[model samples]
Target: MTGLRVLITNITLAGRTGTEIVVRDLALGLARAGDRPMVYAPRSGPIADALRRAGIPVVNDIAAVPATPDVIHGHHVIQTAVALARYPQVPAVFVCHDREAWHDTPPRLPGVRAWATVSDSFRTRVAADTGLAPEAVQLVLNGVDTDRFQPGPALPPRPRRALAFAKNQGHLDGIRTACARRDISLDVVGAAVGRIVDAPEALLPAYDLVFASALTAIESLACLRAVVVCDGRGLAGMADLPTYEALRHGNFGVGTFTGPVTAGAVGAAIDRYDPVMAVAVGQRLRAEAGLTAWTDRWRAVYAGILASPAGPEDSEARNLALAVHLQTWDPAVAPSSWTAERASLIRTLARLGSGLEPLDPGVSVAATDGDRLALTGFHTPEAWGVWSAQPTCSLRFRPATAFGPGRIRLRLAPFLPAGSPDARLTVTLNGQPLGELSFPGADGAEPRDVWFAVDALDGVTDAWLGFHSTPCRSPVSLGLSADGRRLGFSLIEVAIEPD
Candidate 1:
């Protein structure tokens, strides 16, 4: 696999998710293994920040990738489709990291050379669903950076501190009960805790036992912590050799055919937890699921994909692939009903007015040249709309389409000015006041959706959707000197929905 130019695409590079970690590790590992791995993502967050800090190249545009990469590997279906469409001559592979990646079947694209799943259970199911030969979809377990998540010190015999580093809300009560029964102090973390902790690798070593599953479980095992695989679904007890082997094939038995997480099962796992046992499990995982081992498997897969013949081109297959991408966002884009007539007049429109052509005829976008901000490095297809301070350059959109009872949803990039009061956006429908939306003063790229009901739009064939914000200082004036634009809001997406 020497000199292989591998282009890896993921939907987002936000940290706190296992997918981000896998992609980050894969890039770094591949680089270390003497291969060129470039990452393409729509958005940047913790993982992207880390990658940049480590000198790993991350690109936002697929066009920016070399004209002839040796392989295209993607984590999400839409990304795979984009790659296949843009690089029709390249060999591609889609990694099924979650149930949804292949739930509707792999993108029916001609360029996709193979599929890889994080677990064997998914490998088999996806192969069956996509009708690919069993060997075409292989199992590539998620790996932890053993060097970073290496074992802490030996745990005390009577460990009282426990942590639940998972996001499964369904298993929280059981985890609490089990920890209480075992007289251990439990600190719940992850998305279930209302926030995603940014430093999972640093946090795991502080606990004696952890309730997690999937990559978290593997990472905890590497940190020499006794892991109870209760990922919101059910309990798959600590990784004693038997349980480790059984759980390994099923994502630690979290969402894969495991019974519900029960207090008894969790409590029993807690009672059975031993420092010596935890050490043994961690040692085993460090060798088997380490970063080196995982990347080696991917390296071989890339080599195999490149060595194979290109998939035969089929026009129907390309359309099917596009349908898979569209269906992920809306089932209304079903292959049977995607006749262009019933399709949402507006689908995946990036902004009110941008250089890109309109996705629907019913929508009209017009803006002053200065108001259009090119958010070219992100997931959006069009440059985003920056609220212009100038009166005639504000963000406004008019949809010339009849509608039933429904509402319009605007997805804005979460942006809050530093040291400023909360900003309120007054939305209007057809020259009448709909309501106001507020955004807290914070800074992040997470999407915030604001919906305004348009009950008055029932019989109307056209209406104006307007966003007005209180006049504010420009980013540069406010001391964010790098950004000179006096923008009110960055509009990422807007769509109408039936009430």
Candidate 2:
């Protein structure tokens, strides 16, 4: 993987935004991994100097036209993220650091093919706006350099690290209250950090108890302090460094960083953790989640893009012409409407050129006998939990309408109690699951694709789909139309088939 080149775009090196941290960590990690990781950002300040000082080369120019060095990436560079689309022939990936970025404007340029986001929550948001599947959006959590961090100095705080944060967050306030009812000084090292607001800069580093909002936590670790975090939040791979290290060494004057923040939880952390012996934990994480390790992750992405199909805008236009020559094409997925009829699909496919393949034959279907295809039937109580409404079938029926076998020349209708991947149904035939042509979903409040399939089933009498139901989730409704106003099956030239 050595010598693989990657150009990170749209970052200003000097500021302390998460974008900077990501670039710094990425460069540092890449260096450790023996990579040629180049960062492109506005040339200025300590950030640029710092990157250079750290041996990371900086390419400063906002409008710099990027050539194929291997891969071209724009991160934290909104609006321009989709600029990758301009290089339609090039396999480019856009990185989004902000969650609500797409709300105001499209995050992608019709040119870009792939996207990456920092959090799953944020990834989902982007996928919805881009009309891309969630998988099209990759989840690469921010990482940390465990090597540059260690358990914080034992500057005799009025209390210990774990105890301090527990107390500072007022975990003891409950004890203080219960004391009126008979309890005192209880420690809950792990507590929930719901919505976060920035704390005073000067006060953050020296705060008595340190419950991290991920960003600050990893930074605190670099400064040698133990960090307490919510169960799920933290640096992607290396987040567990603090707790694991403290427990491993038995010497940091600390213990595990965990939650369910309770007296028992705190006591357990303290009981088996050895801060001194914990050094191994940090060392191991450095090997596993460190910069070098993550650089490898980026390398694969670069390689995949380099090997992918793409063209310039002019070339894309030519491709459309070629596709039209073939009379088959797919335009950028447009909302289903009379304006976007079967004729529109044919034109869109022309834009796609002959290089792109149709979704899948198995998932494509049209209603032949009627508007509804009783693909399969099932029921759930009004209340259900995280259950997959996704059903698979092995049956096939003649198309009331069709483009080609399994080709959705026209969208009969599409509905989801939820939507998209969450749309609940993905087509599988004769036990084979279709890729890019699949569906899996569950019930939720908002509109989503909870049932769908990339292709239509060809043959079989019986079929089964994976399903789940729980108390916390909802009244399950299946989608049946393109506008998604009705609950029924997509009337394609088929019926539910089984594997």
Candidate 3:
């Protein structure tokens, strides 16, 4: 096994997302076990740089690979399709990490001798999508590098600091409100908040509790943090001894998020946190979900596939399936040129186009009607209005009448602390600067109309209006309260009036 060559394929090595991290850990772990592991990703970034430094070869071009591998461990369908096509005789095992993501769709190809999934939910999904028998789809639960994510110092009797470690920040508002009520400081670190950390293991030890799902939850548990299995979808409550096995079976993911995500619900879940129980659960996870044991499972899968490789008679079927997959999902480009970010941008643009509506000149557009308009970077709507969650927010509109010089008025309340300076809000229309507004600290929570005069409306068919405000501050940082969200302003309404 010391000279066993393994080629791992993934969509992108640009970020520390779930799949990307998994590929990194698996490659490193296999190499540590004396196997030669190399990675092939179309898009490369910091992760690829790190792998190269570790003596593992990461290639963007298939022809650059020095030698063929004994087994191909494929992740995303696009890269897997490319690898399988290039190495038609190679035995490969495809692993599905997500149930709904398009890239996680299992490919039907001749070189693919085995199908696997990271969770029970995705096991069923991959089986259904690939038309494989449920028994045929192997369940390979996600694992954490226990050596890297070892437990830190002992936790306090009560949690003083908590973390929401998820890429999807859907549960943040509720988690923030709940943590505030408990007098606990909350911090967020994920792509959703633009706070991605390459080494989360270094950060997880400082928090007494962590709110995450799937692989993140397992990593947190291994770090001896009280884990709450929740994400953008909903809440699954705290992971305790009573519910540990059930949640573990579900991969501590969406399958366990059966409860609604609200301040009250999240607060109730927070109340169940037990530092002692956290230690126990973490010990169990470290034993059961350690990377060494997980790598052994993968090695076994590779050996099994190598022993009984699928026949090459399904080439026509495989080609037809690949063609249908490409046409139905992305027909304009080849798999080698595709990236996850590009796909997301296209989907977002399509949604924005479909959501646009005719904007009346004199009528005010209320924040409550956000669903009817194209919007981004705003939180869930409240009775009064919607709060801009990020430093920048944007909206799209299409005026009903001919465009001309006009003033765009917005009724927004700045989140200024008692002694802080005035908050500056800069406006832009169709990428052109419109105007800037300065709101004094005394503006308070009362909404005031701020107008931005525009010279012209060039893109009258679909005008994109943007707001870039000064950096946001949290109530906890201001020592006013316990809320942890970086507050900007509450946008109540927007109206356009021709000059």
Candidate 4:
């Protein structure tokens, strides 16, 4: 498969949890496969920075660059739903992490060129809702990162504490009662229970029986405990004999993954929930599945997209395919529920690449009109390679967005870079460097919710969030999380903030 200029859009990488984990894993997988993965986030926080660190290209805006994508992959419903407003071409795939997320889709949606679901069951349900053929929807499958979630010692030694944090919190009641009968403890964590059964995930080890009923279960397993998972049945046979079989073969038993769930099926699962044996079983399954193999599959997916024809809603004439909302540029246009919206905006901007550049071509700014930066180049993997050599390019932006509390955002090029970088920020209130502030990158794209505290803006009309070059090459790399990388060397914003 040839290289593809793919566009990856999503809600936010603001937190260190569920959807974010999947995003990181996917980005990492794409990156490792020799494809350029540009991450366009609407909002960002610590999570966004983490993604940059892992060598993924990140940007804030979409209109900055002129490069068109060979394919577009939306990580979530929001991503696909929103992209319809921007792109004329149909997407290669809309990755639905949760079927329930479709309920939030905008009406009369333009169907993706392809559909992806994390679970086969969810895929069937989505097909019914979309009125599309069941076979049309593909099961991309949400895989567990075995490296992050290896099985630990077997039962007796492994605790029986269970969790159903995000997607699986609904199964706590039945699982708890079953644990009681089995003489094992069950501890549930996450925001679903609210004030009633609130428990920090940090205290998960207090219980012996670990029952994972949702995405949170993966985190529990990551803790290296004996766990049973309910996939289909009420118990989904999460603690069935297979878990025991697995434990007997492995060193320390972890637990088992259930087939699915059934009604009123707690007592039986608890009786059979074997942590030690389950761990072994999960390991074997993972080995058979082979994460490296999974990564290879993702590589194929990327390569296939790169070599495919222009997607729907896309014109075959030009090399440039990816486009975005250039007029309405603000965090307000994003999902208000997330904090990484702004980061996403800026990160996408930095990733804007030249259109249809050769496999080994390069890119440099040909012209700039006010806030609109005109890029002159083709959209190809070679452009990506050249950009990756330097990852980022920052300009002292004109304070067109008002020197207020908002970010000076723009459109970025492609999204294929290695990692985010630590930056050295120096705020200037009237051309004076107010000491120095250093911002750090993270493991993957953990949106940086950086609050750039500029020194007294009292009576000051303009301010400059000083940005000096560092390692991160993201177009949205406001040298400082609280600053900007554009503008004339002259009139600087007298912006003094504790970056």
Candidate 1 weakest ten by summed lDDT: 371-380
C-alpha TM-scores of all predictions? 0.63, 0.46, 0.67, 0.50
Candidate order, lDDT descending: 3, 1, 4, 2
Query: What is the RMSD of candidate 2?
Result: 17.9
Best by lDDT: 3
Tell me the tens digit of each residue's lDDT in model 4 across 339-448.
34345446545643421111111122222121222111111112212111111112222222223333222112222113545544443333344344444544233222
Q: Give the lDDT of residue 2 in candidate 2.
A: 73
lDDT of 1 by residue, 273-319 (tens): 78888898789888888888888998888888888876566778777
Which residue pairs clash within candidate 3? none
| Regions of model 4 farther than 4 Å from truth | 1-5, 64-69, 81-91, 103-111, 129-131, 157-186, 193-208, 218-225, 230-265, 288-290, 305-499
The sequence of per-residue lDDT tens digits that candidate 3 reaches over residues 148-189 is 998978999989999997576567888999999999999998
Count clashing residue pairs per candidate: 2, 92, 0, 122
Off by over 4 Å in 3: 312-499
lDDT of 3: 0.77
Q: Identify the superior model by lDDT, candidate 2 or candidate 3.
A: 3
lDDT of model 2 at residue 357?
Answer: 26
Per-residue CA lDDT of model 2 for 407-471, tens digit only, reads 22222233344543333334433234442322245333332332334354333222222122212
Q: Candidate 4, after superposition: displacement of residue 285 in Å?
A: 3.3
